[model samples]
Target: MTKRRGERPPVPEALPAPVVDAHTHLDACGARTPEQVREVVDRAVEAGVDRVITVADDLDAARWAAEAATWDDRVFAAVALHPTRTSTFGEVEQAELARLAGQPRVVAIGETGLDYYWDYAPRSAQHEAFRWHIDLAKRVGKPLMIHDRDAHDDILAVLDAEGAPDTVVFHCFSGDLPFARACVERGFVLSFAGTTTFRNARALREAARWVPEDHVLVETDAPFLTPHPYRGRPNEPYCANYTLRDMATLRETDLGELATKITRNAERVFGLRDAAKS
Candidate 1:
């Protein structure tokens, strides 16, 4: 991993506590039951993360994510049909998503957007499904959490034309400085994940540096992009500290300031009003 300026190298024991993991799939992280969720969450909480957003990318997973969120105050939900799951969605899928959105626990409408990496679904279907997710967010009065892969132009065009929720976030943002600037201009939030810590992610680092303090957010996208030093192992919410620290260093800011800003950004973008009450 490219070491962030002043990063004290990867020593898990030396990291700070009480960070926020803005995006993840608790269920997909190999945790299938409530007890399992608690185990993972316990580890994260012990590691100092205050909350974790568990994103569901499919109908069943959405329900599971919502249940997990409802069961634990530390967890929040993002519900939608992922780009690859578009084929499974139609009238039934849409109705299910809308139903799930009605639940207070489901704060956002995504983990949606385009993904050209695998092209698991047809491009046309991906666009159509993506539009549905965008409209769902608008209708539900929640911010949108997008997942774009090698489809920046298309994603931007769709968001520009379709209009987004009051708050829009590029989850695990994968774009260069120009895209970051454009998103900032449109008042969108850029969330960096472990990819930002990759040794080759100079473009992402530049974007991180340019993003406004309030507009920057960090996440682990865990069970996936495990940050360096733990890159080969399975990632979890606690690993987000690496991302938070990396973002702080990349933006040339204090870790405390960056952590606070990102925590607030997560709350703002997700429409989370009651961290404790919920």
Candidate 2:
């Protein structure tokens, strides 16, 4: 694991057009209070990442995420008990998540797919929690944000079995081209993270290149997958510009054009109305 060491990468030049850090963790990024949230967001805005969706990984995070969304118009929220944290899942947890998922600014039910890598929670518990989140997304009329790690097959199987929500976003998409194709065929959206910019992530880069514009989005997944050249350093929403630039180069498209498409896609999927301007 890359320990948090060294300085964070300097903010890259602002995007030609604004984009959203489709997935991030404001709490992990040290933005708990309203003022802290605003500071983080202002940095992102300067880098042309105008909005962010701060995703929750547990009950406390879910509450903070919901409250954080209320602090700034550009900040949104996705509430769910992360799959690894589902070992104690129960009725009270379900009711609270259901309630948080309904908040107007809580736009998705997510960061809640399967993770075979950590095996932190029993597979059964993860599966059960994933299914519940899927159902919650459907009920709330919001998108489902997934965190798939070495469980692509099982993730697909569960989504298939449960009947996925109308809108689904694979946050920090880690699959290869074939998996990307499958997800695209299912009308699911892939939110690429800084991982795509790594030198060893050739397959991920290929998937990024092949995925259709409308079926893709960008994120920082900050405080974790900081873009290449800055790997192992703390990340913030502003770092999304680095990932966007990397994707644009690989896709052979203009940065602004890709930014526009991704911005539009985030707005459309999140049901935002001029979010950057609002």
Candidate 3:
């Protein structure tokens, strides 16, 4: 419909700009609608975070993640059925997930892996689904975004058996020093999230130190795990600063240097440079 002559023209608001949000869940975090995503992205860009990789754990959420990338220049996506959703995977599901993998905005193949802590699904199912995702990642030539929760040993075993991708990342890394050392030695990227900012998360701090500079990345995992100073509140990409600052302190480096290194690491692991222009 054409606008009426007497109607005021729409005024364009300046973009807040963007930074690199390694991982998040815009759809699950109440950024369900495009407008909500736009508002959050605006705040994030204003805070110097331009791009965010929105991840999803199920088919519906996966579609939303992909749609989010379509809605804004600041958003990208990762699709997979999380470990807890192992029961949801089936022949049809795998076919659909593979179809989503072909989407241009879908950059990685995960948030998938083992999680013994919750055990929402059987161990065998989780293991099988994990292998499926790894195979899909390899077939699609995309990086694997892993989620290991109290199941690091099993996760590593399977990844090794399945021949993990050349570009693999352990998102929201909360492992002990030994695990961190092993991951770094294997050339796997470890992404530090808001959990890294907790004062009492000493183990994570130690693990942060163990991750090599080039193998380290940062994320918000927003609407959850809000970092310190904003703890007990909702998380957002804008709050990534707290975790980044904590990481800088952990590595005894300047914040800018840490950010630059993490950004580079994200690009290398996720093949962000190969994505279509936002």
Candidate 4:
């Protein structure tokens, strides 16, 4: 099918088994209103993506993500200020995030690590904000979602200094095998995005191929990283199946089995089923 309006790529075919998009941005995917969010999630469901965890990148997004999760049973939320937006992290922002993080629908405290790629926030501010988020995650007993961009060493260092959370997920994991091994050894989950499908992301592919089933999860990180063949196009939760297929091929495993394992990993890390029961 041709690209949709806004150059959105067509949703990929459904996987054999249901899968969860462990990370994505419903707001960035052009789904803000409750109806829009539900529409977007429904599209993903049609593609066999059973659930999605919409991630927040700032204070406003944190609020939106929290409420958006309540909009649909299939939608969950992760709240945190993006490292690039840490320049303004203060008492007010922290308080709001803490409140939002406590929401029943909020599953993780994340997308909060360091991002050396963007000079938007100074290193000092990023470090301070990152530490605060780490502490919050620890207190809340939720997984810490990291957004490591060209700051792998520092990211790991900060997590160590702050005492890493019980469940730490490297969102859009942009690390090589060595770093991946280090995270795995520490019992951190690596959530792969569309980048794993990029032909040039051999190092990332290696990490994805080798990460044990129990420690792995999949995400879209969309309306960005649209996966191979659709790279540069707008992305949404539905596109996760494409990345799953690629990873299955890369790992030389059955597509359905890999899908099941990844979904289960997501469930365990985010306590999805438990949250629903409560």
List residue ranges in candidate 1 displaced over 4 A: 1-17, 275-278
The lDDT per prediction is: 0.81, 0.92, 0.81, 0.91
Q: Which ten residues in a row have the lowest lDDT in candidate 1?
A: 2-11
Residue pairs whose backbone atoms clash in candidate 4? none
Q: Rank the candidates by TM-score, best first.
A: 4, 2, 1, 3
Q: Give all TM-scores, in the order shown.
A: 0.92, 0.96, 0.91, 0.97
RMSD to native, candidate 4: 1.7
Q: Best candidate per lDDT, number?
A: 2
lDDT of 1 by residue, 167-193 (tens): 888999989999999999999988889
Q: Write the per-residue lDDT of candidate 4 for residues 88-149, one digit (tens) a residue.
A: 88899999999998987899998898989989999999999999999999888999999999
Ten-residue region with minimum lDDT total, candidate 2: 269-278
After superposition, which runs of candidate 2 have C-alpha atoms over 4 Å from their true positions? Answer: 1-4, 274-278
Q: Across residues 1-278, which tens digit of lDDT does each residue of candidate 3 receive?
A: 12342331221232232237788988766788889999888777666676789998888888778877888866889999999989767998899899998888899998999989896899899999999999999999998999999988888889889998888889999898999988877778888898888878899888987777888888888777877655666677766766777777778987776776677777777767777553
**Model 4 ranges off by over 4 Å:** 1-6
Looking at model 2, residue 208 earns an lDDT score of: 97
RMSD after Cα superposition, model 1: 3.8
Off by over 4 Å in 3: 1-19
